[model samples]
Target: MEFIARATAVVGGAVALVRRIGAPGHQAMGPSPQIPEAKAQGIMTLKMPVARGWKEGHVPTCAPGLAVNAFATGLDHPRWIEVLPNGDVLVAESKEQAGPPRTLMDHAAQATMRRAKAIGDSANRVTLLRDANGDGVAEVQEVFVQDQNQPFGMALIGDRFYLGNTDGIVVFDYTPGATSLTGAGRKLVSFKPHGHWTRSLIASPDGTKVYAGVGSLSNIGDMGMEAEEGRAAIWELDVASEKARIFASGLRNAVGMAWEPATGTLWTVVNERDGLGDETPPDYLTSVRDGGFYGWPYSYWGGTVDDRVKQDPALVARAITPDYALGGHTASLGLCWMPAGTLPGFGEGMVIGQHGSWNRSKLSGYKLIFVPFANGAPAGPPRDILTGFLSPDEKLAYGRPVGVVVGADGRSLLMADDVGDVIWRVTGA
Candidate 1:
């Protein structure tokens, strides 16, 4: 079947995608009407029973010592952050432009209609927030750099910083004592942004390789790139040489990447293909292996093929399923392998940020969670460490965790909340 046909087949379910982007405010998280196409096929329902036992600590609040900044001061949607040796956090803010359709001056009517009604023109930049004198609170912030082409992800390596966004990647010269990012950055490589709107990034532990993720342009079909040259993939590049290659493919949205110190494996938290309704293909967490594929368009978690996309025979043979599905439509982000350790009330674990759900009627996943690790890797179920980002009744969600970094001290953690524009710190007592 043609991709256009597959796209048409799921047009009814596409409303959920719109709702995901457009639905705003707190009261929207309730038992809601299902999208007919999604519900009829049993795809978009919020079926998971809430785990009542996942109790948060008595301090039902975002931790103190939040250093709000020039980035945090005006950042409407911050997505990722990194810390330099001096203790200042570098923040990435993702802002979107949503409104009436921008006209396309094309003779082809079909092409004109293809342009999005809500077009996004964005910028990505970094800022420095410091808590002077070892105080729990941040005292100063400086605009390190600005004017990035819609940046989203970051990692600090040596004297330079790398950032990934919708358009491509850039390398910044950074030092602990630098007041601001001066001069220009080196352009690593470029990719056309697909519609899922996330570019998660992580550099290897040894500082030799860099991995930048490119999510699918659509939910499940190709934009003529996959069958030709696979686009839904984690791109690995040599930091020094800037030689880039497709590290892994078939993932819908591998929006989170981290290096596990215990095993040295690259782990990714993904936002799988949607439109099966609410629950067909579960979003996932998996160790990303080089040159491997996590099936997308054709197959989903545990070989549940997306019928609409599977209709395209071209995608069937290449479909490779996922490892562990982390539940449906959780919108998983910010994968970080916990530095091996034990802390009060918290088990040894990996940290994953669920940016929160939009497709379902009742909202799910608006917090930071730690997935327990046993010997050295992800071993147990996820435990909620930070709650109340969303309201008690689950109506109003005030924040979304977009990034997590284990501090140099090893026991403390820093969280970047894109929605609320603050860097929350979680300290172990």
Candidate 2:
């Protein structure tokens, strides 16, 4: 592992190419999007920012009139977070599991994963943190659940708590204030495992059903479309019947999902295909429709055909265009809606966490941003809320922000920094 990590670093530095298009934000966030032409590369880009641990007294920078503090630290690769009704936060401390490599590309991907500190044994546990006194810090912490597969997303519906594991959805009986769960809950639905393994789960507004986002097994169906069976789409499951069906298709990898409060519509942030330079087929945030196809391997950004994949004119014609573009290769993963008046200057907007780019020469999206909305649609440009994750040279990353949510109190924001192993709380100054 050490040899592969060192080799990837040395080779990546020598072969990586920088972005020709200056900044990614200019092409992002408008109604009529301007997607740049694709620049196809002969070799896969190997630009990964090295992860650096934060200094003891350091934290992320905040926007003016806002303050940032560490809510909890010393976690094991915390990737996603969920807030309980009782002011407790549950964090899924997980790492990706290794699979056998079938080709040279797979070996190269594994080496890159090691260099990025992305591959290892899964911690397979969830930790609970409580901020009893209303301060931004967690006063008490405990292991809420344990001994599971790579868990990513979570949701609580009445007395039942749903956990989205890489291979299936598990459910458990819940008591509000309890610290731990006793047994491995029943499997509600089993999913087919593939390359993209993080299952993002959410419940319906009325709590009658659960929705799980299953990403594609390979980029552009490189592993064959048959392997993508039951993958790369959002699966809607009935809580009572344990029945599941595809609600939407061709999403590629819809990592973050939330229900738009005003219109009661579902929205998601998807990570698009790579190896198409740094600017084409921008990652997007869009309203998800039932039985809708957003175009994955066949097309991108709504009907822009990717020549790499086998052409399917009929499928491309049916692709629904996304509501907003988030920039190419931003890896935009986390999504949450803040109610009106939650924070001053930012009124009723969506907070998205860009996990940063590994395929681009220059990094993008290692920070948290806000997109203001009016009447259930984006109304203005995105604002940077938390930054300083990347160094000025863009070669080192201190942290990568992932799951973000509006705090239970409704006045603060909570973000899970996966690479930093810390959860940060932000409040108005």
Candidate 3:
């Protein structure tokens, strides 16, 4: 096992060096990112950071005119968040479900993730945080729901509270101001579990439908398209009839979804495929149209063919171009719509939690960013909202930001830091 780990690291470093020299491309960020030609690599790069929790009096660096505080801390793998009607905060304390490594590559990958503290047994629970005193910190903490199958998303529509479990959408009777879910939940929609296990969900504007993101089972469908049925797409579920249908297709891994208030359109942040050099494809944020298809497996960024997987000319031709690129392998997982003036000096736009990168030589993300918008569309470059999650030498990570949302007060922003096990609240300094 030690020999395999050392061998993989040596080969990965060499391949990464060669790829970097050959492509030496510009940073693939912003609306128009440079998409280089794909260079296939058999051995995956694994430049992961060693996990290092924050020391005393340490906090992430916030942008000027902003301040950050620990809203809640000492939680277990908090990955997602939802604001309740009565101003309570719901945090999905979960992690990746560990499966036995089947191949040598899988063993190496699992070891890498373990060392980074990125993979672990799922916590399968949700906790509630209440800040009754109006301070930025959460004064009360309690378990809201338990025994879930790796819950990642939560939504409350009318008297129904929807929980996004790995294998299905579960609905429970919700009473306003309730702290704990006591009633049994009924499965609203079923999904295949394991591969890309995050099931992020959002309710429609009118609260009539629920949208869930299902990522592809394998990168570029290496496991065959049959294994990808009803995968790599967003599904819309009808609340009244309990029926569901594919709203959009070919989104590789759409983890965060938000409703754009300006145009009332649904928007999402997608994590694109990997192993295609350092900057061949970029993860993106875009407005999702009903029945629209964004390219995956066959192509990307509006008809630029990946030349990987089996070709589907018809699907590739109709693939929709994303609105903005958030850099390659940034793993931009958390997104929330920000109205104008929510943060002083910042305009209406989106706040993204880039979970950082492990597959690239030099890392990207590991921070929070804001994209400016005008007339309901992205109009300018993105600005940094938070940073300093990595060590000075970039060899260790103190925290990784995941789910981001507007605080219950509607002024501050709440972000989930899985590595640090803390919920950070960002407000004007």
Candidate 4:
């Protein structure tokens, strides 16, 4: 139970490039093989693996690196997680679930359904956990904010915790040694609920600005969802003044985000538009330019336009291509930059936790992948770092990985498995 088996296989045959474990001076480059799930099984029954310390790749097997294990089990529908300066983990347990799959072909109509779902009170919650004794495993878990319509994204600033709720944004202050919200949360800002429901949060390195990811109300203009109406955007808010503006636009659904160390670039793992048949428009990872506009509704990848929306000329011309596309419907989320290429070796790596897709006939993405880079961009193709959370037969998924963060121990990583309702500690290889 303490051993980690890292089986990294390519998803396609060898291309022009194989990703390198890179360094600070990378210029970027890429290639691959297709691997089936059976080749990467971490034991058969995947009922949320029983953790016996850090049973990750590398290390001397799964030994206890830290004793304080952060528990997120009671988090109802947690979609994101964060670690504060004091080491407390904030869990954003979103109560919203799409009211069944809407017709992807419908642009405006489906957006309505998404908005309605965000307003549902069933899945909204915010909680905190603490392992005060440096034991690594959490002994205290408590609700910091509750009874909100549906909460998704969160960021901690000084003494306050900012939340991205269904209809708007709010905040609660924190006190060391405490784990729950004490006083009433102060409303910070608001935006009308659109058809889509995604409120992811990230803060600037200096905490001067706060970032929020609000997904488009519709996919690529279906049902007439205009881009200006809050579809696919990264919003920037002034923390000191509380002013807001559209930081970047047309990101489809930027699910997870982090700041890169090499160049301090803002990186995002985005869930691109769906329904282009399987493998049409790849999900992508890219650096967010201050006012950059990513492609949506009208165009994708580079210059590929969706014929489905050709009639709308205005929307078509404004779209911008993505950095590099991920294969269709991967639902990419929860991203972090890894300093090591493999265990004990300081190679360049980007780690992303795919939340898995239900739309594709052949299910995909229920685990983690390593995107090795050469200089500063994706060096080669992606490889599976942590798989087996999804059944090969595509019938069931034991867990849906949401957020990933470098742990208290600099050697390993921590993952939030939302479906299984637990946070897993994974050491390097």
**How would you encode candidate 1's per-residue C-alpha lDDT over 1-429 as one tens digit per residue?**
134323532442354445445332332111121222333333432211111221223222532332222223445356777767777777776654433323321112122122211123454667777766664456677777888767778777888888786778888887667867877988888876646656667878789988988877666664454532446789998987889999888887788887766677788888876555454456777778777767776665534556665354445455554545565567778777665453356656678787766555455677777777765555655677676666665434566666877764566677776656666667653
As for candidate 2, its clashing pairs are none
Q: What are the runs in model 4 whose C-alpha is more than 4 Å off?
A: 1-74, 98-121, 226-228, 310-318, 341-346
lDDT of 2 by residue, 339-415 (tens): 87777777887899999888776667888999889999999888999999988887778899999998989998999
**Model 1 bad stretches (over 4 Å):** 1-74, 98-123, 222-230, 310-321, 392-394
What's the TM-score of every candidate structure? 0.77, 0.96, 0.97, 0.76
Candidate 2: Cα lDDT at 287: 95
Residue-wise C-alpha lDDT for candidate 4, range 244-281, written one tens digit per residue? 89888878788788777778788888886654443455
Ordered from best to worst lDDT, the candidate numbers read: 3, 2, 1, 4
**Deviation from native of the Cα of residue 344 in model 4, angstroms:** 3.7
lDDT of model number 3: 0.88
Clashes of 1: 7
- Give the C-alpha lDDT of model 1: 0.62
**Prediction 3 TM-score vs. true:** 0.97
- Sequence-dependent TM-score of model 4: 0.76
lDDT of 3 by residue, 1-429 (tens): 556656666666666666566664576777778777777777777777778878889999999999999999999989999998889999999888768777877888777677667788878999999999998889999889999999998989998999999898999998888889987899989998877889999999899999999988888898899999999999999999999999999999999999888789999999999888677688899999999999987998888898767799999999999999988899999999999878888989999999998887777889999988888888888899999999976778999999999987778999999999999999999
Query: lDDT for each of the candidates?
Result: 0.62, 0.86, 0.88, 0.61
Query: Residue 45 deviation, candidate 4, in Å?
Result: 28
Instruction: Give me the candidate number with maximum lDDT.
Output: 3
Q: What is the lDDT of residue 371 in candidate 3?
A: 89
